[model samples]
Target: MSLTAFLHSRHGRGFSCRAEIEAHHAAAFRRFRARVMPRSPFYRGMADLPLKALPRMDKARLMANFSAINTCGIDHDAAMQVAIRAETSRDFRPLIGKVSVGLSTGTSGQRGLFLATPRERRLWAAIMLGCYWPELWRRQRVAFFMRADNALYRSLSNPLVRFAFFDLLSPFEDHLARLADLDPSVLIAPARILAMLAERQAAGGLALSPRRVISVAETLSPEDAALIERAFGTRVHQVYQATEGVLAMTCRLGHLHLNERWLRIDRDVIDAASGAFCPVIHDFTRESLPILNYRLDDVLIPDPDPCPCGCASQRIARIEGREDDVLWWPSVTGPRMVASEAIRTAIACLPQPLRDYRVVQQGRMLHLWLDAAAPGAEPALRTSLAGLARRLGAEPPALVFHRGLPPETDAKRRRIRVLPEARTGV
Candidate 1:
């Protein structure tokens, strides 16, 4: 890690109030406007325009204009080729000059490309290490489980840090012995993977005593988090990151705080009552490929109360899967968003605990998969769901129970999902 980045990351730029955050954003934006914008051919002409005036960017559009959007003069086709080769071969060492290219297989199944320069990678390493490192003086083993490895992540490896990457594409059973031998001090993985490891530990098939456990790359439900914490005997810190940037991370108190020091976020509100909205990003730190006016479909429910940790940035209660994952139910006012939390809460209230469950909405009908001891659990679930619908002021969708949950996959585990077709049909 660079000395400057290490120093800055060790002690974050604390904000005393909302005004202080805005002032920091103003200075960052001023420097970005003067130095960063002119380099990108796409944003060069729009330097004087307000952030909102710039064209809105999503994965599709970002990939379409990748060549013009990046400040490093990296061609889209060339970068895609390099990234594809690395992904297919499982060798992530290839790079175009100093810029490393990687692919993101989003939940939508659409492939997206992300570029990071050497400086950006250094900053990322510094922030991740300086913030999450358990003990700086002691040599620590770090285990990272990810679908694909990138040069950005490799920066964590040094003589003082033994960074190991566990590939998700391979059979999970194969990793047991290697993981057991490594005895990582810091463990990081997707929430579901972490849950699986926790299950293994609980089953007496695995044993680990990691100082730090972090959940990344997936939306971690409260139930899963509780189980993981119980198994590991430590708080599970979460890093809400994307190809755009590290949007939010857990504070010392384990509260999710938006990374407002490097970027500004504009919310496109979906539900006014709950303060749920999609984040529109404006990252001043991403100079290589400026992520200005980039919008993400993931729904974030904001916490109105201040974080006890005293980070003045916004606190996100949870990252509710995607806009498409949010269930829509008919109401007197029209369709209302039935948040996943409500459904989880209703299930929690059931008299007989379900062994496992999955809720998938298929056009006005919900395929409720329940694994339980007795059939009476169905009626209890029905009653609980009906009560939830009433509380939300919405008519419940038809419930059709299945024997058990469908087979689990390494792909992101989302318990609640509303199909694309169900949105309009509902």
Candidate 2:
């Protein structure tokens, strides 16, 4: 497609009504289902079944059945070998036929490979640019920072769009220097890295005025967003992307809206009171590896009210960490699941400002690594956690405090984590 045509298709000038959005989603999903079911061994069995009746797929099942699950006919071992080599050498130019291979950060304890065809890569670029860049015709530069790179991300590099991938594994000073030299108009990175850059910008160590700043890969905490916006003097936007596909992005009004035009979300509610759910995504645009009724481990709080931006997509109030982060404590009846918010709220209510933190639950013990900006914060944190335990109708877990949290690996940071062995009522 020509640049002008692609822009027009994404902008969807005539797709303003809610009904129009629904119809478009339904049509796209039907077309995708029809095209992939016959080709994909994993999906072929459910070709004649309704989507709701089909068995739900998770990361473990998908990884185990990788070769059969994908319609691309690429062997699982071959894809993994290519993906791992790319990560090790930092050379992502290799591809399996026309399909690009990339690895998931394995934030949920298992690394998975994702495949995207050359055509699918271009489609992804269009959807991303349509969502984030209002002026598609204008020339702009984008700096994307992530642990790994692939052809799918590099496909956006063209005359109209100057795309540069910054390796997160490189030294911090090196990244800062390169970023200053590039002086990109659009900055995209994990929320943690963005927060660090905001600090650098505040200290006059970095010089750049990006028109658009997007948070990707990691959860964008409210604190991180506020800091980034304050430092850059621009609203901090976000892309709710995963290995699955581009699921959502922030609208012009700065609200996170689901990309329901190309993907459908089936909410698996984890907590009813706060409206937290694990989104089961059905992506219509991903043909290489068909993602149908794929359940994600992350938890999100859905917003029921319509967005003022007039976009018909569903809105999300916030992403409440991952389901693995939920604390499972023993209850009178059985092991009860405590929402991550409960622990986060306890820490946020502390007298001192928390610079960074990590909470891990092991059996009846809770380990906390807190970096507080003010003195007398540790005692306050302990007291708050005790209150949280009482509120949940459980005895307070034994607390252990560390001087500092360990540095995170390639995986996305999880402020709260519940050990796998921890039994839960669910």
Best of the candidates, lDDT: 1
**Model 2: C-alpha RMSD to truth?**
3.1
What is candidate 1's CA lDDT for residue 132? 88
- Report model 2's TM-score to 2 decimal places: 0.88
Estimate, for each residue in 319-424, the C-alpha lDDT of model 2 and write its tens digit: 8777876776775865555777678777778878868888888777888888754787888988887777777777677888887776774255667777765534
Off by over 4 Å in 1: 1-5
Task: Report lDDT (CA) for all predictions.
Answer: 0.89, 0.81
Q: Mind giving the per-residue lDDT tens digits that candidate 1 earns over 172-256?
A: 9998899999988999999999999999998889899999999999999998899899988899999999988999988878889
Give the number of the best model, judged by TM-score. 1
Where does candidate 2 have its weakest 10-residue lDDT segment?
1-10
Provide the clash count, candidate 1.
0
TM-scores, in order shown? Answer: 0.97, 0.88
Count clashing residue pairs per candidate: 0, 0
Candidate 2 overall lDDT versus native: 0.81
